[model samples]
Target: MPNCHCFWSHIWNISGGVGEMGANMNSIIEEERVRGGVFKDINPEDEDQQPTVIESLCMNCYENGSTRLLFTKIPFFKEIIISSFTCPHCNWTNTEIQSAGRIQEQGVLYTLQVKTKEDMNREVVKSDSASTRIPQLDFEIPAFTQKGSLSTIEGLLDRAVAGLEQDQPIRKATDPAVAEKIEEFIERLKKLKKVEEEFTLIIDDPSGNSFIENPSAPQKDTALTVTHYKRTPEHNAVLGIEEEEDDRKPVNDLDTMRNEVLVFNTNCPECNAPANTNMKLVQIPHFKEVIIMATNCDSCRHRTNEVKSGGATEELGTRITLHLTDPSDMSRDLLKSETCSVLIPELEFELGMAALGGKFTTLEGLLKDIKDLIVSKNPFMCGDSSTADRAGKLELFGQKIDKIIAGEMDVHVILDDPAGNSYLQNVYAPDPDPEMKIEKYTRTFEQNEDLGLNDMKTEGYAEK
Candidate 1:
């Protein structure tokens, strides 16, 4: 392809209201928007006025055809370029969507529960970089395997099923056993389309542009969960990002990163893919400093982050509690150390120390993670090993956790760290938050043993 004008740059400059027109950029763009809406196809009736229709060589028939490019912006999102190629001679056609802006800073994960046929009607903007999966069926649609599409959820399934069935006839003639297994699997997928049972649909997009429509609008959709997190080195590679030597250096100490973040290159344990690890040292109010380490892996779509106390272990353990009296409290930042125990006295629920490893997330996010790990990731959900009674109980537990995350239930969240390394954000820094409490207690000998403090000698052993 020949080099052309930078599409995004042109859009930005035009929107900036520059050039001889001397007209307000917003006014000009708004006029075009109201007239053209989001996108428009080249109308054959306006042959003389069509700007995007250009003669192109068709790959299928090696004949001249036409390609049209449409530039538009999604409401509340970024600018995008849409292209369509048509070959009338061979009846071959293709459409693709690309983001005109730079790659997003974070990747996105969307989980939707397809419980009813109506859920399949949701609009989906799936970029080529997005991966789709159904956890129940253990089926996946790999990223970049197909071109991008602006289609509905049902349409996506149809496309995937069609692709899988395309080569089955040839395989059946060549290998009977493999074909039989695939035929069985395809039948299962067909059953899924009929909504035989509820299944979870996950869209993992490292580019952060893919979207699943929400009919609820401003209201929260209980059936869908969306999470945005830092991207990995592999993701950057996929997006054609250049790497620097400084990204691999571990010389950056706690103090250096406080001023500016330092990213380090690492390998993901899950897929051995190039990943990115980040460390930040944060000072807690009326408390000591702690280090938060995060890692992202694009290959396996795994996100891992941990938090450790920056300061030396204190003589006494620490316990922190916050009363969730309002919905805003769910947005507060929380740090749970490797040795922290979580509890909700009102819900009669408790998570043992280090059960979830270390995490630094919001109250709502942590609760949702707990629910997802227990319910959707449960191995029993995959086969007949699980009884309906057991599944119902787990479902109820997830609902209760969701209610807590939604701030519909008033409760006290407690964090107890035997190492005294955990911290919770204080909205009122100078003053005490009305519904929060902190206390220190001497660690029990058992707790010390569990923390490996029993073999430690804080004082000098050189005399020995």
Candidate 2:
């Protein structure tokens, strides 16, 4: 058997030589190999040549060697080298692939729906830094933790099944019931590879080094959809490119305080006792806004917090309305600025900025929070006859909100923001629903005057 260290050194030298010589050397090698009748023709001379394979030592065993290194160029992608090692003496084998390319700025995601045998035969290139997920099965192979491989869809599923079978947690599970469930999942994956079922395969690569080929649509691979997205802070950390933490002194350092306590000796609204209030000015850099947060009543154990924005006032008023249909819409992101108001006409409830203050929550979360608040304040509605009628209405409203959240009832949500700092997220872009309306209208005379819009007019200006 060949020495494992010597074989790896040779492999490194070959890779380094290819890097130094460029495509010219690759062409020469391809010509030489073809003339020697080594490999079959894979592409035209204008395209990249077929892969070159070299024998190497079996790292697993020193007695028997059956290792090979295959270097190939992926069409429209970078050069990749695949290494496979098999030990006849120990019956052990391993395969891995590495890409020789610069990291991409934007990450890529490929979503493919596999429904036929041809789909299973499609080529898949997964980088070690990429993650794979099957949404239907709720199974995921996390990124930066798996080996890179050049395989088919069927091969990928087989690998997943093998991985699940070898999983230590599932094997040594304390609950036999959980182990049985895992075993059942493994069987399902095996059946999926056999084309007995359909599944969606999602590959997310932060490095943007992975790919899946579509034979039918060779040029563009229209069978699979590709989406590019900016890498998150966590991805930056994983890639070791995170920015250094700021070490400079903060503007509001406690040592150089104008006042030790901004609003101290204030009486608690709940207990009517002398309470200390601490005020801190915070800046939200992303939104380009400043906020003042005050926490009061540490002494009476009746704490209350308030947030006020110090940003520039908005001139144009905006209103947003959304008709809730799918329960999935409840997960949409929401940002309620300090000057925004939320209204649910179905529930006959309107919360002004002064009432609910500013908050960031999902639609369902906002509804549940409001329901809980109403319940807390109207405890007497459950027992007092004087408030019984109002309590019944409130209870009915709560039930309707619940039904809406569960996708059983349809309702409308409206947000009015004079400051134009509030936002309603649209789950589908470029195809937004007509029912979800966002209108910008002229503010009333009192609203314009309050915001100093009236003072900006010329002397002879008149209402349009």
Candidate 3:
């Protein structure tokens, strides 16, 4: 099996070996020079500092000789190395490209309309991980399926044709009807390469490592349309920067845990009516976090429920699990933060942070609130026959909640607070309570990132 170098050398050799290969390389260099060539010298005045060009054994023709490797940089794009090999014996030639910059945060896509022959001269930097496509031709070259190349629009099309030619088995196995279609498609691509047709070329790179030069476009705008998109979690995993779990304890001030104030008259922020506000400072056992619960209400029926943290930023998150075995458990105080995620595994119902605001209530009150919210406000799930099946499931969930509240069914309540500000009554509290489990675990990198704590810096700046 001949390597890429051998394959390329075979190509040049078949067209006439060293003499022809030299002329081809020279033609490329001339074309580059005519179009304001991108390669630059770090120290042009000193011959000693001339661009470093190294020779190494060609992976494709190791038995023959070495290839040439040139290190250079282009304006806007930095630190790129080009590798080329031309075996004298086998007349095999090949070229490859690589970027020496740091990985990007998001992927990039470049779409260009090939309207003229000049467009074919536009430089393109395609990383090995990028995919190329010609939408008009219904053709695609998947990422990591082809060698990275520093080439022009024509070069890209040529590569595509080469790839198709290499897939002989697929073409041969195709039905007679489709085989002609394939041939026509290949011929159309060849014509496009020769600037005989206009088409659209799109390059999608999840690594944000590819480029399509637009030298003629204005400084603010380019002929190419560039689109950036967030990489999926799976893509991030491959980049070796997968978020780690946050594993730090909350900063709880035990000395501040004193319940002295009862209630204060205030104006409701919602209706600006006279209201009474109740406040309580309670300690979260084992988790070392303090929850400040506030409840406000007025005669106008305007109500407010909020929970604030009395401790420093916590490194680890908190999770509370409660088993409602008796009706008495319904009366237990529950301080849920706006950031807390509530789940009832037995009932197969869960409420995310976006579902509702924070609340200072009991387990039964929380369930009742959820039930009302789903039954009335969530018409998207209950109003139409399109969701008739889900409506039935929701009804069943409401019934389960009723049974649990009536102490007729056993159900488990779980609250996960990545902010570590939520609270649930502990079994070992100063006052005797039913058996409930409270577990604290470190938050994952993704969780901390979501909370805007991953990039938090506490030092090097004065307090305002």
Clash count, one per candidate: 0, 0, 10
Off by over 4 Å in 3: 1-46, 49-55, 59-61, 167-178, 194-197, 237-464
Residue 167 error, candidate 2, Å: 6.1
Model 1 weakest 10-residue run by lDDT: 13-22
Error of 3 at 315 (Å): 35
Could you give the candidate ranking by TM-score, starting with the highest? 1, 3, 2
Q: Residue-wise lDDT of candidate 2 within 1-464, one digit each (tens)?
A: 12323323333332211111113435644654665543322233423433444344454455544444445456545566665565556666676776656678888999998888889977778998899999998989998777888778888988887777776475556767777888898888888888787789999998888988766544566568999999887887787765565464554774434334455567778878777777655444334333444556665677555555555656578798998878888897666776778898877778876456665567777777677766656566565543767877788877877787898877789998876666677766556666689888778887666556677865657766
Tens digit of per-residue lDDT, candidate 1, span 1-464? 01112322332222111011223434533554676554433233443323244567776678876665555655435566656677778777766666656678799999999999989877677888999999888999999997777667788888888988999999999998999998888888888888888999999999898888776755688998999989888998897777676356455655566766668899998899999998778776677777788889989988888877787877899999999988898898888888999988987778898788888788887888778877898888669789898899889988888888787888899999988888888999879888999999999999999999999986896767
TM-score: the better of candidates 1 and 3: 1
The full ranking of all candidates by lDDT, starting with the best, is 1, 3, 2
Best-fitting candidate, scored by TM-score:
1
| lDDT score for candidate 3 against the true structure | 0.69
The per-model lDDT (C-alpha) reads 0.77, 0.68, 0.69
Error of 1 at 415 (Å): 37
lDDT of candidate 3 over 65-162, digit per residue (tens): 44443445644555665665666666676667777566787889888988888889777889888889988878899888877787778888888777
Give me the overall lDDT of model 1. 0.77
Q: Model 2, stretches more than 4 Å misplaced?
A: 1-59, 62-67, 167-176, 218-222, 242-464
TM-score: which is higher, 1 or 2?
Answer: 1
